[model samples]
Target: MTLDFFSPVSDLVLAHNELLSPQALGKKIKIHSEKKGFPELGDVSIVVFGVLENRNDVNYIGEVFQLNEIRKIFYSLFPGSWNTVIADLGDIKAGETVEDTYFALKTTVCELVKQNIIPVIIGGSQDLTYAMYRAYDTLQSMVNLVSVDAKFDLGDSSKPMKNNSFVGKIILDEPYNLFNYATVGYQTYFNSQEEKDLMDNLYFESYRLGEISNNVTLVEPVMRDANVVSVDLNVVQGSEVSLKQKFSPNGLNGKEICAVARYAGISNKVSSFGVFEYKPSKDDEMTSMLVSQILWYFIEGVNCRINDEDFSDDRSYQKFITLVEDQELVFYKSNMTGRWWIEIPFLSNVNNKLKRHTLLPCMHQDYIDACENKVPERWYKAFQKNSI
Candidate 1:
């Protein structure tokens, strides 16, 4: 069956207006609709799908998800320097039960990933990230998840699932495939001390909003290491996304959030990406345009992807070795992009799933810090995770 999950986009919104202009993105991209029908995605690189399920969103109960408003702005924008074929897969309607919706989403994502197609998810709630994570269950590898959010959302796993608490469910659920989880632009006041402590105890990473706002590039390495990246619009300040689920006065501004999205798209390992917690309002032009630009940057990044996985080609990279506190550290700098990576030595005779990830994305500052006898925290955490 064709999943029987997705509904046609042409049926969901008003008749195509500016979306059908010759130079508009809507005219250039394939749409899953009643007239033109579902996309024949053999050459498609990115598929955008909107989820209409939001029963699990604690902040906005029974609020209708208006993804079409987002689409109006997104599809009307002019294309960038992208050559990757893109498709708008339309919306996945809410099922009778939230679990049913999750199943449909998981099935859809799993299939897309299997076909090597990157899914750009516009979600009804951030809890949809749980379903996105479950889509990787069959891959048989440790999953690295990076979320752009203001709060930790580490609610009690014992209770019912909601957007605010889905991360706890992901952590406590079975199968045990999650390897690393990182939160970018997190505000300290929004998260409980216990949740903050939990992140530390697990050796997971967390970057404060102020820290990232001061240095946006700090998220690049984290995004590069991620296999799945989810953005909660609530991470953006109220001024940027005024209609977001939970508006905050202090958070990442428009440009910063878009940069984070672009980083996720540029990551060769990231196969699935989502933007959630958006609630459309009448005066939603700015929010919709912002979301559209974020999507644009992601596509732009995908178009400019660099293949730097292999280091055997001496002409492509420079290798550096430094001694810190009697420990030998090895790093590689990509001549093509100037990106740095540090080698995490695998233990002999160890049967670790992460043994294949010997080299991890890092910043040049980490190398400088290692030279100053300060071991980077990112390296230490990866080393510990690999030891486990």
Candidate 2:
């Protein structure tokens, strides 16, 4: 079905461009803007991807700005040859399916990685997260994912784009070399009883927003062990945030989001992160500029040139993780206070810290031995010692 995007709202010459104008706020949700002119990307690189869909009476206007908006937004942020943000323009047609979307997204990301440029997906839906890993599949065993959102996307079933089930399929299906995957700022209201049960069984770690607000100690490492971070914008506070199928009155604010993003960037574990689900119609006058600033924050995080104003001098992270930490994770349990916790030391991959990692940690009897012995050595030699 061809979703009727152009409403009889305003008399703006937006029809002059590819994107149409909305007559009022919170009514129509299509917010696609075109990139006006060609721009250069020397040492700087970016790829902004956007997509949208419609369901029944609801128009899923998740793409923040259309192709035209892409052009203006990029130049507006960087001004000159200081940066290059290529707009990976999504389609206006309504018949796009998951597989089709996958093909488009996979191709785009692969191209970006091939060019050695980081891709920025503004998001049409959360399923794009899977498309991202698919595009960049080398993350196996080495990748650490940090999701800053309000719900766990660790679902095993449900339609691909149904809600938060997409990432679960990836984790379950792939031989992912995932180090530590953590979900931040989850709200109790959004998740069902069954979902909670599933998460507990799956062992995917999650932190409730209430916990973070109540205790500042829990927020730091939320993005700490992560090598790749992706932010679903729906995690933001609904009172000030617009454009969505679901909005929570209690969520992260702009400063909080910036703080989290800055943390993710400084860790250097973050290669590329994305911001999804912003609807232009529901967006406030301040929305575009805020998004533009958000884009700048991302750039500042990745750039070789450092900003002392926002630089994270917290070398405490150095004691915990490094590029090679994922493969060499051998934990020693500590009976601290009342609960038992493991202190995992970071080791260089070249020095061979993976005393336990193998083709499948689940399949190895050595893993069983190590877990029981609390020793990675006994397990490591088992493969060589027991093999005749």
Candidate 3:
């Protein structure tokens, strides 16, 4: 039987007077409610879709999630000077089984990405990230995933799958498309020592909450190199989100999280983005608005994207080389965006995926550290991965 997984946007919600206002995003975009077909992909396009499947949440006790609460706030906000064609593709209702829902999401995401349309997924649970990651299998290439969360979410692979444990599945599963995984805003108390060691042993990257909260711009280079980005709303402080059920006492503030979202959107390589673990509360208007602004900032960043891929043009980029010990560290800075990247030398005849990726996105501080004879941690990690 053909699974009709997607439900059209409810007309009842569109009937809201505020959503139809001239300044509302709902008025400016194509909605899936009235049988409007998919938007044509031109220079840039974004398709927003929702997945309503939370059975996989480890804390699930058979509670329903109201995603439209976030949608209402999102559609009510005005957009920036964006040239991209934006569409609301409505929701993917939970399937008969969680796996069925994953299959539906996987298929949908793969199709959208193949058409060069970036998918902004609003998900019921973080485990939905597994399906999002699987969508890249058809593309038949390695992937770099960055997760913004309070926990590493790398639960035991031998155990049953849950929202908190999905990353383990992604790392150990077949097709093995994952090349690098980075967790931002992780709290040390939430993750075990074993997990921390595993992160290092696997050559993956993890940033503490304090490290990123102190300077949100530190994540720019990290996001610039990502192919997919996932945000767990729980990463934001409970005070900011005002959700007692799934909020953390210490985490990224509203501004910081939104900044991270925009950074993810600004990346030229990022194709898919997902915001998950959003448990709505009747009293929390702030949560809804914050989610709305996060999405808006992401769109704003997408509009600000510059073409920095062509490093061959000498005029477009300035090159710098630093000698540390016996190694030469080469760096490039873009004239268009002033972004910096360091070259990781490819190992000879290496059949691994890292051989395909030579440039490691870095910051000016990294270059300064290199000049001081201290090898940047990111450069060392990238070199180690390529060496393997």
Candidate 4:
């Protein structure tokens, strides 16, 4: 089993756990340790693990890092009134080569996902998202990725993969499982003109940082449709994190980032989630605490999940149809959660990535816009991609 790829949590972290309150997360969840080996997974709903590979950070200068501090902080926090079973699977150390590390992560994530357990990965660099995305190769035919970052990270695909350019590799690489990619909280100055043009030319979605900061709930519908959600810690404002982790002065605050994590957790379709680009430093208490709270909110969101996506039952949802510029748009609203979804009509003549009719998550405003004879940009992009 891929569990063999993991090393047990350090003795220091476990010893620290002994001092936490009984209601703390460390005292409640199953954990891997030197004494107990691997934990039982039969009843686990969420699994947390760390990958210690960051050689591809672009600015790497042979510095080593660990997740012990983050683990200690996370374990000390009190969990909400949650019913989900969580496990700390410990860390996957950097292998002899980066490729070996990727293989281990991909295999481990594949194992957990096949068992219907969500994997919340804490990573060495944002490029590890490529490994997380690769884990879905055999499990899913088409994958939707949502990245919360300050930059689009679409570096030149011709060169080797770095944390800043891994998205380029994901798009150009083989197997072609990626169906849709969205960037949330992207800072305009961080991305180049070509990268911005590429995002538009490909029909991918990107939300500006100002836009997301103004309305954090805009992430909910985007997360609702994602299969993999990768968050770059650098997306958070520099003031909110450790000195070493400060990537931008202007970015999401702690509260906004936690809300984004909760949205990812609440998504019924999101199977794997990751927080990346964490750099260990001497004064990392604030960063650790923030990361811990992000995990807490995600688990809380998972506990609050409602199965309101099933449209087979007419009583579960309300349907509305509107005409916009000679085209008829159909919308469905969940009676349980009051969430909205717009249908993407199937094109029989075209070879479509989505073989059947699929519901694209949208806001209530999208429906209102359709009633005014205006097409939602999201619906238009999905339709355009389907036709291509």
Question: What's the lDDT for all of these models?
Answer: 0.88, 0.49, 0.86, 0.93
lDDT score at residue 324, model 4, on the 0-100 scale: 97
As a TM-score, model 4 comes out at: 0.99
In the range 1-388, model 1's lDDT, one tens digit per residue, is 1548988885545366433778888878888888877889999989998998889887565668668878887888888878889998888989999999999989988999999999999987899999999999997478999999999889988999999999999999988889899999999999999999999988899999999999999999999999899999989988776554347889999999999989988999899999987788877788888888999888888887888877989999999999998889999999999999999988776777685678999999999999999999999998887777
Decide which is better by lDDT, 1 or 3.
1
RMSD of each: 1.6, 11.2, 2.0, 0.9
lDDT for 275 (candidate 1): 92
**Model 4 ranges with Cα > 4 A deviation:** none
Sorting all predicted structures by lDDT, with the top scorer first, yields: 4, 1, 3, 2
Pick the lDDT winner.
4
Which candidate gets the maximum TM-score versus the true structure? 4
| Candidate 2 deviant stretches above 4 angstroms | 1-42, 52-96, 156-161, 175-179, 214-220, 243-246, 304-388
Local accuracy of candidate 4 as per-residue lDDT tens digits, 122-179: 9988899999999999998999999999889999989999999999999999999888
lDDT score for candidate 2 against the true structure: 0.49
State the RMSD for candidate 3.
Answer: 2.0
Which wins on TM-score, candidate 2 or candidate 4?
4
